[model samples]
Target: MVGAEESGRLVTVGRRFEVVRNRPLLTLAVGHMTVDMYAGLLPMMYPLLAGKFALDLKTVGMVALAYGAGSSLSQPLFGWLADRHGTRYIGLALSWTAITFALLGFVPNFAVLVALAALSGIGSGAYHPMGALNASAVISEARRNSAMSIYTTGGTLGIATGPLIGVLTLGAFGLHGTIFMLIPGLLIAVVLLFEMRAIALRPRRTGGSPRLVPPPVPIGPISVVVGVMMLRAWSVFGLQAFIPIWYASMGYEPSFYGLLATTLVLANVIGAIGAGHLADRFGRRILIVGSTILSVPALLLFAQFPGSIAFVTAAAIGLLAASTTPLLLVTAQQLMVGRAGMASGLVLGLGFVMGAIGVPILGAVGDAHGIQNAMRLLALIAAASASVAAFLPSEELVRQFANRNSNALPAASLPTASS
Candidate 1:
């Protein structure tokens, strides 16, 4: 009876460890989705809010800027902190995100609204690097790309759902309905706290936590990768900025605009999920460059054509152009293995900041020439980004170098004669 009981105990123990290993990514992914839903909430509600406050377009843009600055600009600091310490506050960050967004409905004026938006942004920013770092840590390098893709898909889907959720809830209950948003955030926070504890307590295979020590990656190659990401961000932000306005100007209904937005984001989600698998199977570089190159023609189709063909081309652009994001993220992480948190932040945070900056600039260009011309410029920028992507070393080369360094570690750590 004692032996049988011991065997059963062992089986239970094994199952628990398995759950500990795998469940955090799933939890963080859900957390990511829940928090990012708020990111889209403000934009969706902007029309209603503008009417309520009698604000102009420029004033509305300020609210977005406030949110963008808080959420994006502060990512590097949060990421660095996550790397230096750990993801202890990830749950707190997400919970705060919920609180802030829920309060957005109650703000008395534009200033308070901007402040809450910033707080919401900060909350959103705090989770990303920490969640991404934790996700990478939870999986082996071989499966990292696929795992990250799965993780990212959750957030992308969340953002896509945000607009629909906003329209339904706000339309029904007005601004005060945001109070209902608290439920999901609170639920996810509890899940994250419990799961993160379990993962933390799970025994490390190496018998110790791996301390953050800088890895050696060439500055030139990584710089090129960062540049490519920034350029891609510009195009992404530009499309997102102009698509609705362009459609409205052409006399399309709100429903049509929503469809376009949905198609683009859903296509992006599909691309993000699929591209990761392709990156793992084929080389990362090929998928990155090929996708970017293909997206240009889709943009051209979008520009040159009209009607249903434009919608099809928009989906194509989304599928091909935006699909490479996960691949870029994985590449950055690989290049800086020890600093995965920082890499994630740089790719996500910094890239988005550049995109935000491009919005006004693109608007200016649109004013001077035309919105269509501005979009053409975006296509050109994407092509230029692809050209930059060509500079990245082959995947095999990076992997071989990493393997060589790993193999030499034992020798390097061996005790000297004096010791």
Candidate 2:
């Protein structure tokens, strides 16, 4: 009887231990979701913004460009700061984004809306690297790919929900519905601040005295990865920016188009999580190359077919195109060894900036030619991304290189990828 009681207590203790261990990752993941939810809102709101402001496609694309530039351009700087000082301001960053984004609906003029979007983007920029760094720091080495997928999926899921929320709020309450969005971000921000404090006090997984300077980055491989990522982002972001407008032009109602956008993003979430596990077991390069190649056909199909058939193609595009995100993130972190934060920022920021820049270019094409042609161009971009992805090193090579660099660096100069 006593033995049975002891066993029960042990099981309970083990369960408690597991939950405590996972708490930080969960908190950061939720934070990622909340921050990205704001990003998702923009595309859904674009059609409304256009109608309200009497803007053309190119001008509407500028709104995305403004947000993307602010978010993407500032990431590396914020990442560098996070590495030096530690991620102390993550909650504050989330709160800032929440406040700025909530005000987006209330803006009286196009200029004010654009300016506020950029301001909101800065807050997202601040949160990303800090959140990503902490997410990486919390997990075990063997589980990095899977763990990152979970983290990335949080953001993806938030993005998936964004269109739904936008359709509901904007449909029912007009623009003022944005005010309600502030609640979740603020609540999550508070939770992160409390949870992360405990994590901050814990001993770091990386041993040895901290180094003041990080080692040199592998520019060649990183450049290749960035190139592929940029092309992929261009396709993904371009599709996201234009999907609603295209559907609207076809006479689809806001609810139908919004649901389609949600389906696409939700498919991305599924693909990201599944690909992460696959990459962990199989290899990153194969999945990256394969997915990019497959996305070309998916994009072409979506562009060629409209109506009911479009949903199927959009899901395929989402599944194939965005699936590589977590894989690329893990690969970049593995390559950079000690400078995970900086590498993450560089990869994510540059890719996003390219996507941002591509939106306006694609919009110009749409203005001059047609939106369908612009989408076909995304297929070409995906083909280009596949070509670049072919050049990426295998996961085994990246691991060996990361290991070699870690051996050369002074202890704790940067967190080792393996650590």
Best by lDDT: 2
Task: Show model 1 residue runs off by greater than 4 Å.
Answer: 1-22, 49-59, 200-213, 303-307, 366-373, 404-419
Instruction: Tell me how candidate 2 scores on lDDT.
Output: 0.84
Which residue pairs does candidate 2 place in steric collision?
Answer: 211-413
State the C-alpha lDDT per candidate: 0.73, 0.84
Model 2 collision count: 1
For model 1, residues 52-120, the per-residue Cα lDDT tens digits are: 798554465566667767877888888777766667658888899999899999999988998888888
Colliding residue pairs in candidate 1: none
Q: Model 2: what TM-score?
A: 0.91
